[model samples]
Target chain A: MDLKQSARDLAIEYLLQEIKKGNLKAGDKLLNERKLSENLGISRVPLREAICTLSTLGILEAHQGDGTYVSDSYSEIFSNIIKKYGIFDRSMVDEVFEARSLFEADAARLAARNHTEDDLVKLEQALKKHENALTDYYEEKLKDKDMMELDTEIHLGIAASSHNNFILEIVKSIRYVTLQQDYFSEQYTLDHEHFKRSSIMHREIFNAIKEKNEDLAYKKMQEHINEIRLALDIESIRRDIK
Target chain B: MDLKQSARDLAIEYLLQEIKKGNLKAGDKLLNERKLSENLGISRVPLREAICTLSTLGILEAHQGDGTYVSDSYSEIFSNIIKKYGIFDRSMVDEVFEARSLFEADAARLAARNHTEDDLVKLEQALKKHENALTDYYEEKLKDKDMMELDTEIHLGIAASSHNNFILEIVKSIRYVTLQQDYFSEQYTLDHEHFKRSSIMHREIFNAIKEKNEDLAYKKMQEHINEIRLALDIESIRRDIK
Candidate 1:
């Protein structure tokens, strides 16, 4: 176990150095497993584990039919690492939300300034999915999980439109953390009323971004996050009273 | 070797689970090594390595003589982990700086709203050290490293005053990544004129935060980061021309 773990670390460290030295680069495909393991003088198992870890960290992307390519996006990397280690817990929910509020507010402002037509198309598509989910929740009895995931997609789309990978990654991490929290899920169950409110706010924020209204985007995003945060606070207060 | 590595990982995972379950907590000291090793059914070596890893990740702290305690700051943890794994490199410097600009601008605004008197004292002390470094740059000839470290201290102090751990941790991670970049240090040599300009801006930021001027604090921080970024851009362009 020790050897395998150290070998995995060694493999990961070696690949990172290769990336750092520009021997490996973004979009470069990985060597085959047997060859890479032979080159590293490690067995296949640890090398595979290393690759899995890197993939989770957004440093690599695996294609369905081809092979893994270096992505090096760094978005979702930090929080994903923490999540993989199982260190994130309920106590972190508030901090994650607080960070999300500030991050997405700025992201909205940046999106207003920097988003391209393609970015707008992607965001609009995400918003459309969210609205469809809301309708399905009331009509076809859609699962809360699907709505929640779509909700996150809309937020992430805005972050991506900001043309800032760092902001996008941070927002991704925040969403990942909150999504993992049990109480967050329980408190944020996608009831129609809650989904309706979120849908309306998401549209307003999206429109501000589309119209290039930086101030309005920032303000609306802040309001949207604050409403959710307030709901979380109320749930916790009620739990305490109980 | 495989056994040792897995043991370390098992120890880390176990501790993380404990923290997540509220069985361990921030500020809680650990059992002695022998007891912990016995409890985990691992040898002392892997257990120690696990402790070391956690300490590097800011999830644990080891005193000079006392046993290790859980810190759980999360600040510096993510970047420190990436650094440990050799994942961070020169390619990340620009993104780190861009994120720092947006994060610190909001951090300054939060500091203006949240800073206590003690926070002001820390900021003032950090500023004083920066000014001293500036004076020594001309007189006693301070090394650029000392000046740069002090410069980071001032910025981190402002982030710390923001009263948001998530913001503090993100800012900490940004500083950690930039500090590790070889080109960053080479490009950011603290010439007297540069130090003087930075000193002036740092003081203005500190004063704005002290006076509880959130808007001014945010604006000043934005200006400060933009100045540094502009200098960086010019230097890169010059290097490219060369």
Candidate 2:
């Protein structure tokens, strides 16, 4: 029932409205502080806070001694913001897996159709990294962190090969959440058996993409994610009982 | 390659690292500004900017007489930030549609299985609103703005019924972008036929969800989104030729 609007939010909302109304536009310099604050009918403190917020989000760019201007680099900003803050809860684990199952599987299919030579090279390299990480884990030479990162790298590589920015960003955001699993829960120990099995699945997914077998790539990726999800489902159910 | 980190970014990163290392906990008040700024080897100016930025994003909260505190409300913060800046480019139209096709179809299926009575009531109301908007549009009484909003409401309502916060937030972000289609392009005019057809699809999808027909709900939502994508593809192709 708290309908209060913070001063900073009001200022931010005003600027967004101007942008939406076409009065403020990409690359357009904002009005100087005194004039803007006067026009907004608020003091400069909240106004400055609003600008800082927008600039941090990369929606606005500020040049020292010049002024702030609307930014045209929306794509990168969008990716960075989502990657940094999109997933933050332990309860969101199942949702993340569900999202990855749908999006990453489709990404694999698209990669099979659209992957460039460079993408194939990257995917191969990522797969190699996963295998090495798995070996190192078995030999007690690597930590679970390396295994998790390498695994994610392969999935992100496939998302890149899909040539769809949305998939790449979405995968990155959700994968980031999964990587932080160790941060939230007891350190997520990667067993040698699980690591070995994951490596095998990654190899199969990579080979499918390499061979341009779209359906196989999609199915393999789905199975791999589904396998992981099964383990997570069991863990969550155990937690509930506890 | 600009490798230089801005002062504000440095401060923000330092704070995030502290949180990650468990040195700072949610609801814990931040160190006093003077002490924190000294610790970071930076002046208070950029530090304040960092705090302001996080506060605006809801990652941190600032109280006037008290101090800034790490916030536990990360889910709401994640949703707000993405909804505000996630989709920012004209080139992203195709990507948005592709994401929607994958996520929303799955969400519809989940909704069929998981929706509650309240969810059904909300969805029904959204459907009625859409029908009314279409009627108003046909009668020359409604603007494209109302129609656009009403249309997105139904999709968002379906996403809510999925009972997955991730799906709800994702749908909200993407749909917010679509709503700005008019802001980015020359106003998007919804023709009578397109509106009518969309309304029909919404009703069918709603019925499938209401009847708890998971596969049918998924199929209907996919068909609905694919139909929209087909038109978009043709438009993009035409634009390329021109």
Candidate 3:
């Protein structure tokens, strides 16, 4: 490795050690550059490079004219990475859906097991919003973008209900990536019948979670995602035939 | 959002769009800063920041005296983020194991469905290595580090056999995080009996894959991971009681 790269890696490793040791924490201001560089026995240049790299990774935040601080969430860093490198070919769409299905199914199972009353209420509201969007779409009063947002909101609510912050963050990041790709590629056509079916699937998943049926929740979520994958695959085939 | 942050986001989004359009590819050198910045309607400063961000994320590589190019694998980026932020409390260890179990079980299923003769050969070799390590441990000749490496290699081989790049990347990242945490905490004592059990589980999983039994592979892998989780939980409780 290059000297600068090695230095950056050392600095990052040290920072992670500090965080693990509870010497540094989320939202805590880091030591000043001079002090930190001196303490790490590295030059200011490599230390700054490491800081910048961490800031870019969303583990650290640098405020203008203010000291840097550890970030409270690594979700944004994850999202940033997803946005940058998650461009997939048409063939990879199924892989994306497969991965999403795995995540959502597991998230649903966890949500069924762990959801609080508050989480149930949130899921109910999200389901209502999704139902309303589906109704509007059926009436020709909602655009695809509105429907997509509502769909994402409902899934995000389920993921949040899982009560596992790590899984929640990852599901959210994957959702963002898939949504961005769909938006950019105009991948899915608005099918009224498919929308109706998806609404029903959403309700089934919600009810399963509310009833605390972990297996049912997992099955419903998995079936819902698999349906979407099938639809996309058919759409791609149709486009190719065109 | 901060102006600079927004600018970087914009540049990153535009670059992603370009990649989706096939204007850039893995190992493709980015356009010169002057031309690219002007084309993207951004100043060079923010553009450079975005480039630096991508480089840090392992999506791009900045070669000394050479222009930057897209990276072939995004696995490094995922591993980097996991390494930086996967510090969890003892309670969260089960959650981590749950997530890993989900990933690894699915990977095992896929491996059973997709593994070629070559893939099976690799997996068998990995299993053999793991079995050797287990024997060494039984004889008090193997270190924790050696055991961990062997364990990771076995899992990585299974993931590779899955033939899904995305799942492989995720499994690799999760393994890196868990191994790092285990190393740092000395969380798992060297239990000869546990090692023997694990070696048996590994063999069962390998046989399932070799037999092309997807469901069996999934079940065995899931059981193996849950066993590990149970052991860790017990270990943590014992430590608490101490």
Give the per-residue lDDT digits (tens) of candidate 3, residues A1-242: 67867777789889978877889988999999999989988888678767876876778899778989998865566666755565432245556676788878989998998899998888788878888777677787887667878888889889888877667777877786666566222355534466678889999999999999999999999999887765554456334421
User: Whole-model Cα lDDT per candidate?
Assistant: 0.75, 0.73, 0.76
Please tell me which predicted candidate would have the highest lDDT against the true structure: 3
Q: Sorted by lDDT, highest first, which candidate order results? A: 3, 1, 2
| Two-chain complex of model 2, DockQ on C-alpha atoms against the true structure | 0.22
lDDT of 1 by residue, B18-41 (tens): 876789888899999999999999
lDDT of residue A10 for candidate 3: 86
Off by over 4 Å in 3: A1-76, A83-90, A183-187, A233-242, B1-76, B83-90, B183-187, B233-242
For A34-151, candidate 2 gives per-residue lDDT tens digits of 9998998888888888888888777788877698899875434544555455443235555666677867887898789879999988888888878866666788787666677777
Q: Which tens-of-lDDT digit does each residue in B95-202 have in candidate 3?
A: 667688887998999899878999888878888888877767768687767777888888899988887766777788777666655622345553436667888999
Q: If both were scored by TM-score, which would come out higher, candidate 1 or candidate 2?
A: 1
Per-model DockQ: 0.28, 0.22, 0.28
Residue pairs with clashing backbones, model 3: none
* lDDT tens per residue, model 2, B1-242: 11123777889888877776678888899999999989988888889888878877877888766888999864355446554544332355666677778778878988897799999999999999888777778887976667767887899889889877666666776666555444222233323456788899999999999999998998999899887655343464325421
Pairs of residues at least 3 apart in sequence or in different chains that clash in candidate 2: none
Candidate 1, superposed: residue stretches over 4 Å from native:
A1-10, A14-36, A42-76, A80-91, A183-192, A233-242, B1-10, B14-36, B43-75, B80-94, B183-192, B233-242
Q: Write one digit per residue (lDDT tens) for candidate 1, span A97-198.
A: 667778889889989988999998888889888887776788857866677888888898898888766677677777776665543454444333667888
Ordered list by TM-score, greatest first: 1, 3, 2
